[model samples]
Target: MLKRKLLTYALISGLSFSMGSSFVHADVTKLRLAVETTPGDPLNIMLASFRDTLQSSAEEEVELEFFEGGALGSESDLIQLLRAEQVQVLPIGSDIVELDSNFAIFDMPFMFADKQTARDALDGELGELLADSLREKSGLEVLAFGELGFRIISNSRRPINTPEDLSGLKLRTPGSATRILAFEMLGAAPTPMSLGEVYIALRQGVLDGQENPLSVLEEFSLYEVQDYVSLTNHVYTPITLTMSANSYAELSPDMQEHVISAAQEGAYQTRQLSDTSDAELVEAFTSAGVAVNQPDLASFQTASVPIREAIAERLDAVFWEQAQNILEPR
Candidate 1:
């Protein structure tokens, strides 16, 4: 994939754009979008929609291509490539913490009420706050926001119906300190691991349980191994679509607007798709025989108070205040 992109880079490098022009006809600018989910997963489905939308809306102005299911690399590897300008755009899930720790605000336990509330916070000023951090700290332009859905806990050991049930269970979490801390506060032993290793770990008894949205449970087929799934909707994670600032800078202002607008449309599509798919995915998991149960949500929410305060003290105060203002609204 890198070689193909490099070749395309060379081919387009010689094409010169005339300044003050509203559009560029010099060469086709294909925005290569990367994600770690497989073809049927919501992200890929959204990417296909993104491609069609970009083609129809900007047929001559630009193009969009996708390398899904970790084809380019894990989100981490892809970020390095995005920084190097090897790829133009990639949708990131939790790894946004690595880009700007302010994003760790999302990992705070039991933050958003539901997918719609999460979308409103991100689509409003709060989203721009994190986007500003990324552009300033990482040279990435925030194109739009999508949904990873709310994360639920699934286990092989037994049912997790409360915070106490989580005690001593080795739960697989992303390699984020905030996530690990969240699990610890909820009385589970958080095991930080890459998503690729999770299935094998569960099969080998290396992990007791893990958490993710229903789509991921379906995508990874963890339901095949894990006997029980506890709907402990602890965190609502948003997928971020972004481009390298340098790439955005190189395009004519009008073309730049097109890329951002196309990405935003794709993101809006993904959010809508996710909202509709979550209930169906849950029902499918239940039919597949994965024990699904909703724990007392108030217990989980109450347990999160100190965890919120503790992590907030560790993160940038401005970002924390921004989150509070958006969620609670001035």
Candidate 2:
């Protein structure tokens, strides 16, 4: 009887140990990162760095999966997923923030003077402030800001040499209030559409033309459907790498630090690639039979001034002033 009782106790202990071990292994952290950019885009190159770094440095098996090319859905869809903890991370366009009016500050027309100005503002105090504000207000942690280059105008109608040339032309823009207003203020009809639908719409003539970074223009092969590529360089658009606050809080402290560091490195590498690859992208677009034009940017800048005022009224003057201070030379 004593031997049988001891045997039963041992069996129970072994079962409990086995169950605990299984639970621990099953709980190993796995992350699913989503990017709207295509596989060959610079953003993907940056994300690859993060995946590689996390895999190498993580103590446990940290499985990093990617959903690219809008497979996970539009930026807005992914943002909602992050809020619901349905996905882990998203490197999305700045326009995604238009869902909240406060985010419109980033989209203020001609906000950053040039790519260099954009980079400086993003990597400096302004970037940190914006990231913190998003975290506090939107419930997401901003890991780092990645560059998508300055937006350019492309249409089959004609070359957009000045704001006057864009008059009466229908331009496709993301569903951001600031962007719509910016295009309208510039005298173009702004049509808000999902990124996934853009290609078909452009091909079918459902839309007249679109504005995007050269990298995106090349990625979606927009150069094929469009004729003229104006280097408007009007808006310096930045993509944000964001993670869910809930998922972030669930991570171990060490893991959290590792992830944040990796994300920062990814953003830096992406920005570097964008800086170096612009010339190559322009050349590629030209070679593909797309007419490239570097217009008189001063006119476009002058036309967008009204857009800034309109946005400031809705987003607050303080936010606009702070952004300007960051962009202006110290």
Candidate 3:
């Protein structure tokens, strides 16, 4: 059995976790997994599945400590904890682009025709390239890529039927340069903030709109504050399950297999959940008295051309070309 020595205290975002406070048998190995998402959010669901899968299949005793709802802090803060070996695993969203800009490809508007196309590319060569770049640049292990689904716009303002309707509206987005630039090109004033701050900002009129997967509306109870739901379906983001290299390296080979297998299983469940949630949430939002509209995507797609072209030029030429080739019509 593989045994891990526990640190007495690990600090993250000014919070300390007592890893060694609890007694454990010498044969038990503890894994720390966290996400900044709410309890029922996709990221949290995936993490729970990973923990269950790993514990069920592992040869030795596996103890997992699950932290959710920004308990450890924001996604950025979680990344830092992983880097410091304070946290062993994290499921991160597009904020990961900050770690390696190569992931900014996900921020490109209208990039994926559908989830399958996006999944195909990510489960194939393009995924490998991005994973390799991240591993080489940051000593993290990319276990699996789970779906964040396609991002749609939600607003307290009037219904958005076209890109013109977004004009001058203050939209909250993650701190992604390409994503912000895309919204700017579409005529919205983009505001970058942490996920935890978005709801209050919208409620207080600091942001007129925000974009995220439909599940976010239900997960964060955003429907109460946002009146209109625009089916922009602009960007498809994937949450990556990443492990600290230090933690992964310390695992025995058999235990490492358990980790990888569990991650893949959890990722698959998230993809299925995203596909079903999109259709169901539309009806849920409408019943909640929110006006939902399908915007003129052609106009949005047309306006997105420059940003795509610009991102292609900024990214590695080989990766860009190969990603295009992999995502091309079959």
Q: lDDT: which candidate is best?
A: 3
Off by over 4 Å in 3: 1-27
lDDT of 1 by residue, 289-308 (tens): 88888899898889899998
Candidate 3: C-alpha lDDT:
0.84
Question: Which ten residues in a row are the worst by lDDT in model 2?
Answer: 18-27
Candidate 2 lDDT by residue in tens digits, 1-330: 476456545544543453342221354777877766677776676677777777788856577767777665556656665665656777767565654466676667677767777787788878876877677777888877887778888998899898899998888998887788888888889998876678888889988899988888887788888999999888777777778777787787888888888888888877887878789988988888888998988887787778888887886466657766766636
Query: CA lDDT, every prediction?
Result: 0.79, 0.76, 0.84
TM-score of each model, in listed order: 0.89, 0.86, 0.91
Q: Return the clash pairs for model 3, or none.
A: none
Q: Is 1 or 3 the stronger prediction by lDDT?
A: 3
Question: Residues 251-322, candidate 3, lDDT per residue (tens digit)?
Answer: 878788989999999899999999898999999889989999989899889888988988777677877777
Best by TM-score: 3
Error of 1 at 247 (Å): 1.2
**Cα displacement (Å) at residue 73, model 1:** 1.6
For each of the candidates, the C-alpha root-mean-square deviation to the true structure, in angstroms, is 4.9, 10.8, 5.4
> Candidate 2, overall lDDT?
0.76
